[model samples]
Target: MKNNRGLLIVLSGPSGVGKDTILNSLLEKSQNIKLSVSATTRSPRAGEVDGDDYFFLTEKEFKTLVNDGGMLEYAEYNGNYYGTPKKAVEESRALGQDVILEIEVNGAMQIKEKSEDALFIFIMPPSRQELMRRLVDRKTEDEATINARLEVAEYEMSRAGEYDYVVVNEKLDKAVEDIQSIIDAAKCSAKRAKKFIDEVLNNA
Candidate 1:
């Protein structure tokens, strides 16, 4: 059994940067890393599964959990509440499973304030033009909304320097590979490896 504790990976990126697609691919390639399912008050979108994608909750229920300290981080956006369940993440880490949080900048900042050990990664698009193109291609948002998102993306990208690593999502496969390598390297970091070293020395 590994004596080292699992890592908390907080991933954040601008909208339309393919964060979801990259995360899905990362999970498919890696084992022992679990997605931290967030709880939200918003109605499920098309094909979004409750409990799997998010723990869909009513506004009252979501607020109750937040008030009770059940959430590690919570944020309100577009009149909907979204948060990470504290217990789920704690339990997963206790079992030595790394938890990846695909969250927004606000939520990621909250996590950073709480857990200094957590690994923060910011995803970037190839260019501003490419980001705009991807947002328009989605067809889910109107022109006004797309423009709003682009403005927000520019601001979010400005915060990329705050993260531990910045990955450019030029190629899906390469991005996944890059993040996987980062995770592996993080596991071997001196801070995490020291726990195993201490255990061995004490046992000796």
Candidate 2:
């Protein structure tokens, strides 16, 4: 008997913390939530489909959206632009669907500034050594890149206190369950149910 608007859940974590793996698992298990697809200037990698993985755009297009104020939040990283499209998020929320935004810490902070009610969740690894192992296992980046990522991860982890919830991603299933529970609990929050409560009191 929930009558409130949908929840905006922002999930962020340091690099190599398995955020993507956890998010993919959570989406596969949950049907009530939708992923907020981001628009990026980076080229689509192999097996990455446009509109599914990302709305790949040219640099010009990305700058145009930014200038037109069409993006909810955007950031430039490694000379590429990435942003959340305002229309998709607004449309999904209007239909009472919870929107899950898997973004970076900086992007999460931007969302917080714009939408204070949004739930922010930060994922953490079991240990720094494990995180390093995970990064090396990927074999995607060079040593220098990995070192840079590690440095950035340390800084991102420092800001974990800014988030509303911190879920340790030691076990995949447990982490997914923890986030699902957080979403359920957030939906039942007093702020979300205020309208119903006020109506009941008025009628009484």
Candidate 3:
């Protein structure tokens, strides 16, 4: 009874977690879902496409969009603005495509405040040590940056209680399976099935 509208899924996790990897696998496995690309005011790096990588915007354009309530959620960092475009999300959902918003905890919380129909999912690392190990193994950042990420991760994990589901990312395959199952169950929820139920009763 999903009807003609798709579910809005908000996925949030701390930095250094394998959220991008997990999401890539999930997208490869499913055709009915699509990632919600974010809009940003930052300049694109090498080989980055304008619309594909991000909807690149000037600062004035970004501010105008935000002022007009065109953004689902937004944040400013390092003098650049990043946000989810509400129109694109609504258009996708209207086409019965499940749109997954991979954002930070604060953005997820903003979605919660604005949209009650969204399902919030948090990705949890196996443990602090394992998370740190993964971050260290990347070797892309200095020790200080890695330590800062760990601290931020702790804060993000503290807010996991607010999410509807928390998938521990110990095993990639298992975590993806769990999320698939969760989405399947959410689709069949009483609220989602109400339309079908009404039609059946009316026919009877």
TM-score versus the correct structure, for each prediction:
0.88, 0.89, 0.95
Task: Enumerate residue pairs that collide in model 1.
Answer: none
* Candidates, ranked, lDDT: 3, 2, 1
Question: Which sections of candidate 1 miss by over 4 Å?
Answer: 1-4, 43-50, 58-60
lDDT tens digits, residues 24-62, model 1? 888887788899999999999999999898999999999
- RMSD of every candidate to native, in Å, equals 2.3, 2.1, 1.3
- Each model's lDDT comes to 0.90, 0.90, 0.92
Clashes counted in candidate 3 amount to 0
lDDT of 2: 0.90
Q: Against the true structure, candidate 1 has what lDDT?
A: 0.90
Q: Which pairs of residues have clashing backbones in candidate 3? A: none
Worst 10 residues of 3 by lDDT: 1-10
> Model 3: what TM-score?
0.95
Ranking by TM-score: 3, 2, 1
lDDT string for model 2 (1-204, tens) is: 456577899999989898999988988998878999999999999999998989999999988988887787899889988999888888888898889998888888888888867999999999999999999999999999999999999999999999999999999999999999999999888988888889898889
